[model samples]
Target: MPTTQHSPQGHGHAHSLAQGHALDRSEAKDSTENGGEAGNMPNLSTLSLDELKQLDRDPEFFDDFIEEMSVVQHLNEELDSMMNQVENISRENESKGSHLVELKRRLSDDYTALKTLGEKCDQLNKKYLKKSEEYAPQHMRELLQIAASNADADCDRHVEHFLNGKIDVQTFLNTYQSSKKISAERKAKEERLGTQLSALERAGI
Candidate 1:
């Protein structure tokens, strides 16, 4: 029978290769258990070409790397979707804010217009009240009294002229009678107005 033996260097090389494969499998299992977290997975893009080639040569490691890459891609897509939703919400809020501003401005304008209108109405009401007061019963009665006194004075003047012979009897009689009639009518109106005012006062009007 012939004898065969393995060299010491060959034994050491085989042991190192076995250790490298075991380490790679352990890392891959840890990455999978952790749900392929970014920190646990290697960044293949940053790897040198020679390192990538080495990884590609290992079937189990390449498969694990591919799975991790897929998880990263899915995460990136979800993040992009979330960012797009945030942008859309921000745009909607901005539009609502603009509408609110416009509404506020319109309300301010309406308030100012209402205030001006209120002031104008107050001024008109004051003017109307003043005009009404000028034509009140008390003032009208005063005017009527003055008119009656003037008529009486005119009648007296006419009588005097007639006595002085400056006016004829027919003319004096006509003028005096007209003056007396006017005085009587004015006095009657004044008396009637005073009576009505007194009645209103008694009634608390």
Candidate 2:
């Protein structure tokens, strides 16, 4: 079976995008709750060293900062779990997709084989029919008649044996019935084949 390549890069990129979107939502909510305008959102990296030191020394500011960091940490852990789930799902999809592709390929091959077999069957049938027309009509009629005659003789023999106590009732019925069935079928076939023979004779074939 052919193998499918599933690069980790694509899966990682997708998960990263999802994590970024989640963080963005969290940041937006934090900004709204703080009653701060988007433009006033401070970039810690842009702050002067003295300004950062001043904020770090403020107890109230530090408490709020720690609280916010805790929320961000929790969100990161949740995002990590989401990323793992997405990775598993991606792997499962790849496995299932590969199996599906193989199944389709096998089905296609089987269908092609069956189509070829069907065509050959049709060709053989046409050839057989042609040969049957060339030589078999009279032979088939004679065979059917002979089969009917033999079946009738077998049926009469079975009945005679039953009457003479050579066979029990059950054995006699089973044998006689089977012979009669064969006789009936052969007689019917002979009649039908006789019609075909007559047609062939009239057509001078």
Top candidate on TM-score is: 1
- In order, the Cα lDDT scores of the candidates are 0.92, 0.84
- Candidate 2 residue-wise lDDT, 73-185, digit = tens: 67778999999999999999999999999999999999999999999999999999888875676777677788889989999999899999999999998998898899899
User: Where is the poorest 10-residue window by lDDT in model 2?
Assistant: 35-44
Q: Candidate 1, clashing residue pairs?
A: none
Question: In each prediction, how many residue pairs overlap at the backbone (N, C-alpha, C within less than 3 A)?
Answer: 0, 0
**Alpha-carbon deviation at 84 in model 2, angstroms:** 0.8
lDDT tens per residue, model 1, 17-74: 9999999999989877886465656677798898799787988877667667756667
Give the lowest summed-lDDT range of ten residues in model 1.
Answer: 35-44
Off-target runs (Cα >4 Å) in candidate 2 are 1-68, 138-205
